[model samples]
Target chain A: MTRMFYSLLLLSSLALAEPGTVIRKTDLRDKPFLDAAVVGNVSSNTQVDIQSRKGAWMQVKLPSGQAGWIKLLNVRTSSGTTSSSTALANVIKTGSSGKTVTTGVKGLSAEEIQNARPNLAEVAKMSSYAANSADAQKTAQANQLIAVQVPAFANSTPTTAPGSNIYQERRR
Target chain B: MKKQFLLPFALAAAITASLSAPAHALDLGKLLSGDTLSKGLSVLSNAGEALNTSVKGLTPEQEEALGHNVMANLLGAAPLMNDAKVQRYVNQVGLWVAMQSEQPNLNWRFGVIDTPNINSFAAAGGYILITRGLWDRIRSEAELAAILGHEITHVTQKHHVKALISSKSQQAGSDLISIVADYNSSKSGAKAGEKGGKALSEIFVRGLDKNDEYVADVNGMVLAARAGYNPYALVSVLQLLGSVNASDSTVALLFSTHPSPQERLDNIDQVVGEKLEGYADATENTKRFNQVKR
Candidate 1:
């Protein structure tokens, strides 16, 4: 009975241990072009779930579940992952809502139209920011960030309202 | 034949001695006989002739040299604006407006000085300077054009030249001394040129009359309007002057020399209203202005 209890305890300890624990935070380069090249950036202010480790590089899953190698410093083994995932989900949801309004193309309310103008501006601003950051080789999620932002803004602003189109054209 | 030549030569020598004898001494016949002025200098020849008759001083060469010295000093003191695009743009705008002036003489050179002073001045020989501070504050190109037109008039009318000549005639050696003193002051301010000449130049620059300013204002406004700029730009710029600090004594002097801003506005309103009352709304200059920072 004593031997069986000892064996059971060992098994339970093994079960609790997760595979490939990552203990550093990493940031994905916001520029899509730089996302793949290590020359562009490293894991920014984000932690990762370590899928495996290779020498100095840790192959980990991004918050997006995309796999990439990060320097050891950029990820840490923590419960922050769940909150980050939730935030990401919220971003996607909000972004989709915005995109729906922007792509609606035909009918929009006055408030929606007014709000959409800024959304377009915000999108343009993000694109410009991404371009500059990319040139500087800085890690910026500018495109992703703007992608999330533009739609939410477009939804809030209706493009179908009277005189909005004119304003929109001028702004563009 | 050689004896006849000697007679003329002897007469010329006597003429030269008589002209050099007194401070106001001049051989009027000899001055009129010889075409001492170079080509294109004839525009100023008659005036210089009349001026010599009145003052009876300064040889033709001296007058030419004075004009040349003034122009050289102007060029040396005022460097062209550094920014290529802006410098080019200003020159283009200035030249366009200048072409409309009564006397569009010389290739108009425009530059922005890196000073916070709300001032603009046109030197003899088509040197137009507008301070960056003034340019930045202007809300429209029309205002700039109007101001440029005004400065262009100052140059074309030879206002500074006339002032210099007057000072020389009245004060004799004091004019040269004052010029040296002015140069000294500018040097103390670390400005270009010797302090004395600079001082004289400043004085001369400051001596523009009220009528000259009014004529410039009127002509400038008309030029701007004809150039497709909003005619109201002149009035608007004058009004803007009230908001910004006008501590630059030259700028204040310029305004004082002109009709009051209110007076100018009234004149413009009357003239433009009468002529362009039924005209279409001016095409908004949003596009032209977008290229420039001010």
Candidate 2:
């Protein structure tokens, strides 16, 4: 059954049909650039099967089997999902000490985080990355980035009730 | 504390004595009848007020500690990118943007995590990390500054603190408030503290509320502009993300955790549309960015 499934997966990848919907009205061109002859216009919400990508354009085939490229940003993948949720379990491997140890994946899965012990060593390591206010100020001056106060917010009236510890400079 | 309430009541009694003495005699008699119940209720109300004050979000110190733990968990997933220059560059750019925020003195540290996933994180305190993949994709410092600006807003606004309480709304009550209140002293928590700690780490997995994300987007632009970087860099990056194939594995993690790039682009555009003088004159610094990135 596993062999059958692997073959089916390979077959599916060979004959792909990843449908996506257009996000906005953009030109469907013979080539990826705007200079190419406009084959047609793929209006917003129009569906197209994504084939491949050029620099910034997605090559898609129309339902009528005519293939062309569309601006990559114009479409949303129909079946594509962002599932970085904690589904993968903790990985266990044998260490040099000849004992098994549990380590997490490259990007933590949620379960691994829930079960993993607190890493104080890692916490201290990140702290070494700290840049103090003075050092930060130097970076600004070097870049010629002057601090300009944008008076969009009401400085006098804070958004939240100012706690005793909150440093509020009331120019009022 | 009782004396404070007595002063107000004494003044009120003095004022009412002149006009409503006869009327007050009847009211006073009624009050005396249930004086015990009223006094108990007043004490309870004051206790409620005290609890409300205590539940107010973390002090900067507590927030700082929370950010460290959260950042540690994130680093556990992806270690810090081993380039000191790159890390230093992120800190300088991020700190410049943060200095203009409300919490200027926050221990703002920026890191580039060594991961292929294209995602940036903002914790409760001023800890932020942009993955190496996202760093490589950005073409200019202004764009990077804009991204940091958005994440910094999350910190300044205490979105992570609020998110911890919110995600546990089902079992909310005093226990929820206790998690926020006791978050300051890491050792002060019971099982509630344990739950809150778990939730804080889970922030990397569970993104903030959509409204909070939008608020960060708009305000981040403002901060980025104030720091003298082109504010529209955020929008341009949003457009770039929108252009990337949604099914692409590099961006799949980002795609799940944030509002659709199209939605964020439209929402943030509304914020950028609000005219502020000289924002157009903001710097993009494409050349310096390319050099630093290299």
**Model 2, residue A24: C-alpha shift (Å):** 8.2
lDDT of 2 by residue, B129-181 (tens): 89766776676787898899889988877766555433222122233334544
Candidate 2 CAPRI category? incorrect
Best DockQ among the predictions, by candidate number:
2
Off by over 4 Å in 1: A1-172, B1-81, B165-200, B245-260, B266-273, B276-286
User: Residue-wise lDDT of candidate 2 within A72-167, one digit each (tens)?
Assistant: 556655433323231121111112222222233344345555665545465566667778888888767887787787764333122332121111
| Candidate 1 residue-wise lDDT at B9 | 28
- Per lDDT, the best of the predicted structures is 2
Against the reference, the lDDT scores of all candidates come to 0.42, 0.60
lDDT of 1 by residue, B142-222 (tens): 678778877877766555544433322233223443433344344332222232223334433344544455556655655
**Worst lDDT window (10 residues) for model 2 chain B?**
B1-10
Candidate 1: residue A123 Cα off by (Å): 47
